[model samples]
Target: MKRHLTHLSKTILQNSSSKTLPLSRCLSTQEAIERRHHLFTLEKKRQVESVGRIEKIEVRYKGVPKDCTLVMNKDISSPYDCARHLSEWHADSNALALIDGAVHWDMHRPLSENCTLEFQSYSSTEPQAVNKAFWRTCSFLLGAVAARAFKEDVTVKLHSFPGPDIRSGSFIYDVELSLPAWSPAPRELITLSAELVRLCRRGAPLERLEVSEELALEMFVDNSHKAKQIPSIARTNGKVTLYRVEKHVDISKGPLVCHAAQVGRAAVAAVHRIIGSAAGEPEQLYRLQGVALPAGVMLNHFAFNILVERAKKLNPARSPFSPFGEDGVRNMAATA
Candidate 1:
């Protein structure tokens, strides 16, 4: 069974490689999405099998509505698991988890040791971290939508996105498209928005995985744009952060919302073609912009309209590049 599984995995990887190359303008959006979904499933299976053993970890949890110590499986007791011990509300609304009250942990990433845990929701008094995580998650999801939004012929190469920026009134993703010198019409932008809504409507929980830089590169090498960004992303820790939604893995330092259902009334408000950075840089990258309200935030259309209008402008957090070659757009909404 092990050998057969290995052979099956290798076959899928090879098939994915062959089908994805020779970028064309002939593949439909549905076909592209199907391909992406298949590759994601194969990769996720490989990742799960990589974790060979099980162990136990003690979690000393502290936070609102109540506090308790949880005995959980090591590398299996995610913050989300701890939340399940609290309440449905905690499991759903909480956007970020603070371990030892300082280390910002992804809600779905496993806990490895005994430590105090705190869950932060968007409405917390000091919600800076939660907001940032929400915003970064927004940017991350923007990438996911963009990946599936373009027709198969239009190779959507996700380069990198700046960190979350709420003050900018939106999250941003700078993507490299194989199609050159093209601008999105209003109708096209709306279609992308619909795609975002469709994806969010599925309510997939975001899962986090920490992999060595080598594994990270391996996972993303198929996407030229992301492959280009991996080295710079790993320069600081030599490890890569990956977040999953229905098996779609991508790079990000995340404390994303517990589930996609939390995003309500999403709109892909605009796309701006960014040009002329330097050689070896993506000659043209599109900044995809959007605004999202949380599920419980009952905003009147008037207020929501204002947010939509504000999000249409070019977000001024930081340009997507810096001295370290890392994307500079910091979290307008990520945990501090």
Candidate 2:
């Protein structure tokens, strides 16, 4: 099975005449991911360097190995850093950092003030927020895989994913591909799923960074779809939140669970074509759907298959293409 998947991934990007390439694909999907990733790195480094005089804050940690107060760097230290001071298990599990028992903050996002902190994991008593984060991370990962899954001549632009609806049974990504019409074969879907699992196993943190609108626009200049959304997303705060995994970067208003390795028992169940509501220039975007359980959740194969079947149905999340230019275009209402 491993050998077959390896071969399948190699050939997944080969062009098929039946699925002819679009004229718009000047840069390959991998090229675009790399370009955006570079800008994200530079912006992140700049932000880190600009946090000049190091300030200290007291973080009242409220769980595991007894509650204790930790002195950490302000605007420079993240909950992830606190976890490191606690235990490797906390660090590796990628716990969701809950601030003051009220707000759920990303494990990696810097804490701005002196606040009480607690960690939440996939197996927490109330895992709703953690579950949502996991789902969003999966959706983001799906977009990364989908982009490079296509051939160089093919234009694969990520449209958007709605906020997480676990009851809807799958995480989704709406992508506008250059192909006029194409259907994924069973093997192709398996290949996509395999690629996602492979990525998760390799271990990558879903790092978060908030960039100015100008920088966000510069980062996504290669992709017209994201460029259109940045103006609206940055309208409120003038800052766009971005998440990066390895070399892939995308937009999100995120508190994503710490890492990708938490995603386990995954499947790319189906792909359906969705019609765009943007009048005159209707888009035929493909809605890619899949289901994933957090790592360590044990389910028999039969039950997992049932979930796979359910995810094959069309997701009911509001179409990202629905009537644009309206006030308040949201940051990709993602996995969560």
Candidate 3:
């Protein structure tokens, strides 16, 4: 049975490679995504194996149901595991984890040492941090959907997304497409929105991994913009944080939501093109804007439409290519 399963996996991989070969000539977006995902998986597996010995840590979970101390594996167990110890409600609704009441950590990231843990959901009394994480995840998912929405002929290079600004009324991703003078119609926008919804329905867990600068550069080498930003990102922590949703992987300084399903009501509000250059930047950049509410937040259609309308307007986030002062540039690039 083991041999048969291995053979089956190989067969499937070979078939997929053969099917995508024709489009692989130009390094299609799908192929690039597959390559990056494969590299990420290999690197993640290597890192996991390198942890030959695992130690136990005390996790003082302070949240609903009750506050208790749970002993968990150090560098192996995550807050999600602690959530599972509580209840399904926690395992599902928790968006981000607060460590020692200070660091906002990703639910899936392993605990490095003994610390207090608190889960944050969208409905928390102060949901600002959770909201920001949700918005950032939306921006990241928007880039994934946009990268796959177009035909294999179109070259889509994802630039960078600004830091999440919930007050800005939308999440944004700036992409550069090879197509000239192409604008999406209303129907096309709806289709894109549906695709995003489909992705959310899959309920894929957002896996977080911290990788070395070398691995980060290699993973994003296909996209020049991300490759450029990785060095700047690594300069701070000496490591780059990556998040994987199903087969899609991207770079972000993140404590993103636990899963895609946390994004319940979403719409591809608008795609605005930014042309012209004050500096030596690309003349064509497309800003993909979208609005999303948390899974349990039930707003009326009219109210949701208002949000959609507001999101359709241009967001005032910094451009990826704009030359700002050192602090401004660092802030803009840190969020990407």
Compare the candidates by lDDT and give the number of the best one: 3
TM-score of each: 0.81, 0.89, 0.90
Tell me model 3's lDDT, rounded to 2 decimals: 0.82
lDDT of 2 by residue, 1-336 (tens): 221123324543323321233223444665566667767778888988998999999999998789999999999899999999999899888558999999999898998789999999987899888988888888989988887666555677886777887899999998887767667778878888888888888779889999899988877766777877788787788988899988788888877888888888899999998876665333688899999988889999999999999999999877766654332135444222
Supply candidate 2's per-residue lDDT for 47. Answer: 85
Model 3 Cα displacement at 177 (Å)? 0.6
* TM-score pick, better of 2 and 3: 3
Worst 10 residues of 3 by lDDT: 1-10
Task: Output the worst ten-in-a-row residue range by lDDT, candidate 1.
Answer: 1-10
- lDDT per residue as tens, model 3, 201-297: 7899999988999988877767777776788889977998899998788888888999999999999999889774545456788999999988888
List lDDT for all candidates, in order. 0.70, 0.79, 0.82
**Order of quality (TM-score):** 3, 2, 1
lDDT for 119 in candidate 2 is: 92
Better of 1 and 2 by lDDT: 2
lDDT by residue (tens digit), candidate 1, 186-239: 777777788788778898998766567676665555565566666766677887
Off by over 4 Å in 2: 1-26, 280-282, 323-336
